[model samples]
Target: MPNVVLLLAALAFAGCDVFESSEPVAFTRIALPARPVLVNGTTVVRGDYQLSAFTRSVNDSLISVPTIDFDRQTVLGVFYGGSFHAGCRGNVETIEGIRLAGDALIVEVGPLPDLGPCRAIVYPSDMVVVNARATSVRFVGAVPQ
Candidate 1:
């Protein structure tokens, strides 16, 4: 009877909302053909022209980042700026969470996987379409080095 009561208590506490922010922002990850070389750190792009210019900075082959409706959505780009092994690919795991706090969007980046035996150098980058209008973004729990 005691074991059952303890189990029930644990489950009940687990179900309770632990995160401070309850309001979540909708987001979708987008793929890029090559890693961006110019833009580094967190970037908030609200206009088509800004996004277009960012894509042009990539030195790799001509690529097309997913066309987003700037009026309805915004793009958030997170780049590590550091080079990693070729096996370390970004976006392999889903983004953890995005929540709204006041007018700022708080983004949580999940861990990066370790693929064995990497010889070539590569840059880790990720882009997501957030379905909310925010003036700024705060990144938490960034990609593991």
Candidate 2:
């Protein structure tokens, strides 16, 4: 009986470490819009913001979602979940001082304050056929419709 009690106590203590060391899953992908999108009434070139990828990190509770952007070789933007203080619930708000290469389109999230560059690739599953003009570009499986 005493051994069983000790084992239970040890198991309970170990569970706390499970949440402590686990990092949130970060999703990275390149998203292309169906059609050309206009930013501030300006028609953004097709390839200008096309090859961009983003990484978003979510907490264990799935409340706040912070995103970071990597455009070919530059960090475009960083947005935090300020409005959704309880959990991950708000859209990415761009961080100032960081300029996206060419035009602003896709963004991502990171743990540090530095953006890393990476090559962009369009996946087969990400291709979508649409007739209307696209307004924004996002990472695959990152943005919610």
Candidate 3:
């Protein structure tokens, strides 16, 4: 009898929306060419991806390119163009979560990680594939200004 009561209580809480978690958006890490000179900012690729800030030919091949179905998907790119000195080595931007807040879609990114001092040039970048189209997409948390 006690076991049945406990199971019912657990199921009730699990069905509650207050305890629901946001669905994570799918993403992939793209490798940029050696010493890639890219503009520092967020870039959204919609329709045709022919943006000058994102197009480059490395070894006669395109780098950081992803196949997309523009009819139902969108690509969001986060790039840290400026090189960071020692102290902040291995700094990179990571997409943490993507969820709907009110009527807008919010993309969350992890903050810069604190690491030991090391002499290395770090250029953090990420490519995220959003599954749904939104009237407005807003990026929040840890995005390079």
Top candidate when judged by TM-score against the true structure: 1
- Give candidate 3 regions above 4 Å deviation: 1-24, 51-53, 57-61, 83-93, 101-103, 114-118
- Output the number of the lDDT-best candidate: 1
* Candidate 1 error regions (>4 Å): 1-20, 35-40, 60-64, 86-91, 143-145
Give the alpha carbon lDDT tens digit for every residue of 1-145 in model 2.
Answer: 9999999999999897654441222233224322212121111223323323121121122322223222223222222222212222122222212212223333332222212233322111122111122345333223222
Candidate 1 vs 3: which has more TM-score? 1
Model 2 scores a C-alpha lDDT of 0.28
Sort the predicted structures by TM-score, highest score first. Answer: 1, 3, 2
In model 2, the Cα lDDT at residue 67 comes to: 37
Q: Model 1 over residues 1-145: C-alpha lDDT tens digits?
A: 9999999999988876554554898888877665545434666789987777777666544544566778778887777545544654544443578888877788888765563356555556677888888787788886434
Ranking by lDDT: 1, 3, 2
lDDT, model 1: 0.69
**Window of ten residues with lowest summed lDDT in model 2:** 122-131
What is the C-alpha RMSD, rounded to one decimal, of candidate 1? 7.2
Candidate 1: TM-score?
0.69
Q: Model 2, which residues run further than 4 Å from truth? A: 21-145
- Clashing pairs for predicted structure model 1, backbone only: none
